[model samples]
Target: MFVQEIAPLAGSLGLSALVAVLPLATVLVLLGVVRMKAHHAALLGLLVALVVAIAVYGMPIGQAISSGFQGAAFGLFPIMWIVVNALWIYRITVRTGHFDVLRRSFGKVSDDPRMQALLIAFCFGALMEALAGFGAPVAISSVMLVALGFTPVRAAVVSLVANTAPVAFGAMGTPVVTLAQVSGIPLNTVSAIVGRQTPILAVFVPLLLVIIVDGRRGVRETWQPALVCGLTFGVVQFAASNFVSAQLADIGAALAGAAALVLMPATRKPAREEVRAAVLTGVATEQLERPEDRGEVLRAYLPYLLIIVIFSIGQIPPVKKLLDAATWNFHWPGLHVAGSSGKPVSGNTFSLPFLNTGGTLVLIAGILTVLALHVSARDAVREWGATIHELRFAILTVAGVLALAYVMNLSGQTTTIGYLIAGAGAGLAFLSPLLGWFGVAVSGSDTSANALFGALQVTAAHQAGLSAELLASSNSSGGVLGKMISPQNLSIACAAAMLPGEEGTLLRKVLPWSLGLLLLMCLIVVGQSTILSGMLP
Candidate 1:
């Protein structure tokens, strides 16, 4: 039987931890500094992890390889599965011209540009994150802002900042799901903890967006709607994630935030010169006409509504039990490994959630959406194919990243780092979020960061006498802030804003926001671990 040892190099935890960091370091340096392609960097990191697992950690070579395969399977099945179907659902909307209808509806929310930032950047961006994360929200929202007459740099910057609040629940809750899967925590527990943490940011991001869009003048005049949107989003996100389904958290918050704006007190429009200054393209914000028919707006919104309704119904006890009955659970072959307790580690087993998996639920939602939207069967198939094609490289990166994670984890590399970091005792609570933030900054994905460090957070939390759920959820909450600074995201946002080769400018603009928010999240997590413990679920 293969066994894991926290410190296998001269029995020194520090030295082993130092060695264990190589695979992660390899991935980060290549992505962040070398600017290597993501898939290539991920594969190289997997190679480093395998070498460390077998040579440094003394793991069995066969089991190491087997462990990597197991992780790749999980990545492909549930993680990427959820992302693909969610994107497919979005593509179906795009293919049928409903997305433009929805876009115009948002663009016409208010004549003032500040309200548009709240609606499009904060609210609609959250909806995009919920459906097709991994930088799609930043790209789409930034481009939409430019289309609506905002400066390209401002569009990219505010979109990056506003995209932070919903990231923990992005891509149909894949990031939190990955955190739960890797940490051995229950999905609901992770979701509930994250729901509490990120919503705090939700209450502030709308305000930040208004300030960015129009400076002090924007806030002075538009703070009412910003407060209403942010407050509604925060409350609904908290309620839905805790009491309702985590998968529907962002969707609920997005719709609620938008509704709050629609029902809010009216505000005066910006001056023409102000619009011209922001737009620079000479396009007037009020020129884009809203759809005249309320019926069309209802149709544009039905797919998201259908998702919430269907997923919520699936959460009913009887239906949940029936759906879960089809899941397959089995121990993985060629992956027998013992933890510190001298018992087989349970993570070596794999679960196939079948009808209960997020992918399946989203598939059900997509089918309903196709019917309601009147998308032809042929076009639906085409959208699915287009989604697979678009996500091909992303699929490779995710699978490789997961393989790297499992190799590091199963061979004790992560445990070594965990034990080392746990040496900080209570201080680990304050430092935990930085680990996730740094990971995401380099890797450009909250899901990837969670996969790499979720188990480590749990291990460190146990050793540091902190709550595993707190640190685990803190990882994601902190990582959301890092999304703005990720090189990949900067590139995507710049390209979308038509600010090609201006990534440096965009990076400088958003870096402070990312760091400032990260500090806030760090403080929040520290408090949650101590005096603010009541905040947790």
Candidate 2:
């Protein structure tokens, strides 16, 4: 058995880390520089990861291949599954023309585009994120915005930006749960800390939404509703994440905000009697379209509802056991390499059975959508067939990114990167959020980021004489911003918006904002650690 050594690589961690970054670089270059599409970039990046895993990391070929395959399967399933089903729901809505009604429903709320953005992108999207995170917010909301008359680019950018605030608690607070597990910290303590830090973000995100939509005046004009939305979301997010289930935080906050919007009158528009008359008539006309038939819209919504139900059920303890029982776990044969630490470091693989995985549920959703739409079985088969070719590149890209991430994690390259950054000491406080950003960028989930680096942050903070809780929480809070730039995210957004070649363009637009948010989060961490010591749990 080959042993892993940390000390020998300590001196060269920086270089090794750079070597580990090659796959990511290859992906960006192929997509952004060469103008290649996501699929091609993904495949190339995957190939690069395979090489690096075997050569640079000294991983056994068999183990490396197995690791790659396992990660690819994960990428295709739950992560990609969420995206596919979400888009399918949207398509069903469009196919049935319910989206037009959905759009009109929003118009009834407010005619101002900025408010619409805040309501749809910020508030409604958060609920979607909370329910089914893996890119659900972007995939669902961006399309909703596009349908509501926002330009496709604006929809994509806005949805990406708006997705940031609730991500730490996404997938039912799975990130913090993972962090707690990895760090051996109390789950409530981890949840509370992350909760505290993230609400600061929730407060500003609604304002940011308005600012992005129509600048400072727009924000100022709508500041009341924005404040109400932000405060409600922030307060509920803080309370729910700490006191209740973390997964319910975003969903509860979002629902509250949306309810407030529905109840609150729009302050921007003066009611015109004629326009009022038209609206009243419109409502009557809409109601007359047959209440029974309109219920079909709700029926069209069932697949998504089922997805949430199934995913949630799968997460329950008893159900988790059943689901896990079907999972295939195997020791990797060849990838273990001896490191200076004298530990066996290698790849592993796990495959949950189709009946138990989120993907299986999503595929079931797709089938239900076909039946609900009354589309022929042959047409449904053809639709899925068509979906495969269209999604080929997206699938390739996500798989590649996941493989690179897995390689970095299994080969100790990620630790090398973490060590280098942590060596910055107390100055690392200002960089804590960026660490989360980098982790999320690599792993594509804030939860994954927390799992990857929560322990590292704690270790680094202790070494640097900083508060470990504050720094660890900063990782979760700050990582939310990176949600927008993650390749998995970009792929999901593009797939949802049907903007395949525009992922880079979408990335470029949101990249600056993501960094800006991270910087803000870092400052918050510094303050919480130094000036406000009692702020963290």
Candidate 3:
């Protein structure tokens, strides 16, 4: 048994920690500094992780190979599975001309491009994330943004930024659920705590969106719309996560925001012509031209409706049981190294078959969408092939990032880095969100981030005399902010936008805003711990 010693540089803890961080640094340098393509950068990062895991961590060759394969397999199944299906759904709509009708329907609500971005990319995407996650929001929203007349770069940027706020509670509350499991906190407490922190930011996200899209004067002009949108989203997100199932939080908030746009006059603001003129340079006005078929528009939207229904049915007891019955779970052997006391150091590994996963649900929706659109089988197959071609690079990027994440976690280097923060005692509260931010930045999913650090946060909270639930929830909430700039998500957004080779520019644009919001989340968590005890669960 190799018990880790927590010295600065003379121990396995210190060495492992440095080894873990090297790959991440390689990612930043390769992508941000060298301006390499995302796929190439990701591959380089994965190589670094593999090398460090073998040489520094002293992990057996077979165990290391097994870990990488496991990570890559899991990445492809659920994560890539969701992306492909969601993108396929979008492709079907475009190929069948139904997306034109949906675009027109949105325009009928409000001709303002800014408002459309808010409604579809932010609000509607949140709903999709709540329903299917695993890259669904980024997949759906980025394409919508592009179709709405934004340049691919701008569309990618907008969708990535907008997707951030709802991520922690996305996909039937997976992130919070993972947090609960890892921290050993009651699920209700984690939900309430995350709810308390998320909605505070939700209140300000619309204002932030306006600022990002159209600067201060533009935000001033759209104040009423921003207020209505933000409040509706924030209020429902706050209420549903705390009072109802956390799984329903983002979906409820999104529906409420969409409702505000549909029913509330003040929520649909007409962007001033002058502001539109300034930002619409080099853009063909044809892209923003509204469609004329309202009935057809509703019909065009059946796929998304079916997505919600299918996802909801899959969550039901009997349906879920049948699905679970079909899933194949396999335990990984030979990777568990026993401790001195004879307990295994590594946890059990299991694989749930793809057909039973959230990704498969999205895939089924894509197929149903194709059928509803009445496309011929040949055309449908063509659409699927084209969709795969479009997203191939992104699939590679997601796989690489997930592999890097697994290497970090298994190497004990992440723990070494966490222990550095945990050593800060009371100061750990301020750093908690940052740790989670780093986690999601690497992993691109809050569920993975929470699983990586939730227990660590609990331990740090106990040592620091802080609230364990609050800290754990804070980690999840903070993870949302990091989602905006995650390389995996950025890659997905760029792919959906058809904006290849510009991932770095998008990252630079969104990084400041993401970091600033993360700081605010940190403050909110600290305050919840010290000032507003009753406010926390």
Candidate 4:
């Protein structure tokens, strides 16, 4: 078997590291600078990775190709599978006209645009993130914002920004779970550290959403409610992830935030008659015109409610054991090359827990949704087909990026890059989050980001005399910010907004927020490594 070499550029660490970054740089330049479509950029990035694996790393051509196929297969299963089913559930609601009732119900809570944004984009979006989370929150929430009369660009931006805080625990805490598994860290420790980090961001995200929605005036008017919502979310997120099951962290936080919003007294100052008249003439009229059918509203929300129930049930120890008992575990074919450490490189076996996976739970939710909504099987089939068609580009983008990541890992390119970064010593704390940001920006999933950088973060922390749990969790927390800028997520948001070629526009809108939050995460992580080291669980 061919062995992987960490420093393949004439055994030079710096040279090998530089070469290792080429695929990532190619993707960033093509998507961010050249404004290429995400699928095309991903394809080109994968090609670069393949070439580097063979030429630079001396990976066998057959092994490299097999690695790509393996990654692609994984992407299609648990990742794309969750996305497709979640969107299909959404399509069922839209087709049954129940989604309008849900929108109207939210509209009833607050007519102010800023308040509406807080409810839909921040609160409800977090709920979706908790439940489905593979671009589903951005996809569904952006469209819902538009239906509430937001401009498509604004809708996309709000959804993307709001998606950040809940992501580490999203998809029933998949990112943290992945971090625990990959880094050999205790799951609760990872969850608790992430809890500490992301909850801090949760406290500010609603305020950020208001600023994006209605500018300074929005914050000026809605600061009280925004503070209430953010604090509630942050506190509950911290408590639940630390004290309760990490798997239910986002669900608990989301419920608390939404409840806080609903229970808090309306703090919106009344507008003058003239200003109110002008607002009414615009989208406010559409908002005011929505009919409220309590039953219809309940039905509109039933799918999501059922999703929470089903997912929570699946998380129970006995149920999980039963469901996972039939898992399929096997080593991948043609990927048995050894790494520089003289161990098998990419032939680790994966266990496919078909029934217990989040994707399967989501699919079950969709089936329950069809039954509850009384949707005809024929119509359900059509909607499922449509959902798949709409996600065709996203499927390609996710698969290609995953393939690139696997090849980098198998060829030892990732190890070279990791070692170079870890050489920063104490300074690595500040750069840790950026590493995660880069990972999620490329792979488009916080779970994928954790898989890519989680172990690396732990190794770096050990070398730097820092807290491994802190840095590993930081990888996940920092990755949440990158979601707003991820090309795959951007494409999904754009598609949901029905703006096919506006990916660049959406990226430009969200880039500043992404960087700003990422910087905040860096500071938090740096503090955790030094002055705030005791804060780690």
Alpha carbon lDDT of each predicted model = 0.87, 0.69, 0.72, 0.82
Q: What is the lDDT for 264 in model 1?
A: 79
- The better-scoring model by lDDT among 3 and 4 is 4
Model 3 TM-score on a 0 to 1 scale: 0.81
Q: Which stretches of candidate 2 lie over 4 Å from their true place?
A: 7-36, 39-53, 128-157, 168-194, 214-217, 239-249, 267-293, 300-357, 360-381, 436-476, 482-515, 528-537
Candidate 2 lDDT tens digits, 461-509:
7667777777787888888988898777888888877788787899898
Query: Which regions in candidate 3 have their CA more than 4 angstroms from the true location?
Result: 1-16, 34-57, 127-160, 169-193, 212-221, 239-248, 268-284, 287-291, 338-342, 351-356, 438-473, 483-512
Clashing pairs in 1: none
| CA RMSD of each candidate after superposition | 1.9, 5.7, 4.3, 3.2
Candidates ranked by TM-score: 1, 4, 3, 2
lDDT by residue for model 1 over 1-537, one digit each (tens)?
A: 887898899989989999999999999989988999999999999999999999998998899999999989988988889888888988887787777777777766666777777888888899889877888899888877877777788889989999899999998888998899888899899999998889989888988888787888778877888888999999999998898877889989998998888787653354466654653442434346644577777887888777777778888999999999999999998989999778888777999999887788888989998998888899898899999999999999999999999998889899889888898999888888898999899889999999999999999999888898999989998999899989889999988888889989988988888888888899999899889899987
- Residue-level lDDT of model 4, residues 1-537, one tens digit each, is 878787879889899989988987887789767879878988898899999999999889998999888777777776677768877888899899887778777766765667778888888898888876878888878877777667788888999999999999887676786677556688899999999999999989999988887778767877888999999999999998998767678888888998888777763444345433433233322455656777887899999888878877876789989998978988887777786778774245555778877778888989999999999999999999999998898789878877777777777777778777778888988988988898788768887778667766876787677777888888999999999988778889999988898988999999999999999999999998889888887
Whole-model lDDT for model 4 versus the true structure? 0.82
Highest-scoring model, lDDT: 1
| Tens-place lDDT digits, model 3, residues 1-537 | 333222324565556566566877887677656868767877888788778767776666776666666656655766566657666777788888887677656655665767777887888888778765666687777776666567777677778878877888786676786677446688788998888888888777777777777788758777777778878888888887898767668878888888886676754556678866755443443444543665787777898788767866776788878888888766665455433245554433555655566668877877777777788889988987897897787678766766665555554445555565566876777888888898787657787677657766875676577777788888998988888787778777878888787778889999998989999988887787778677875
Best by TM-score: 1
> Which scores better on lDDT, 2 or 4?
4
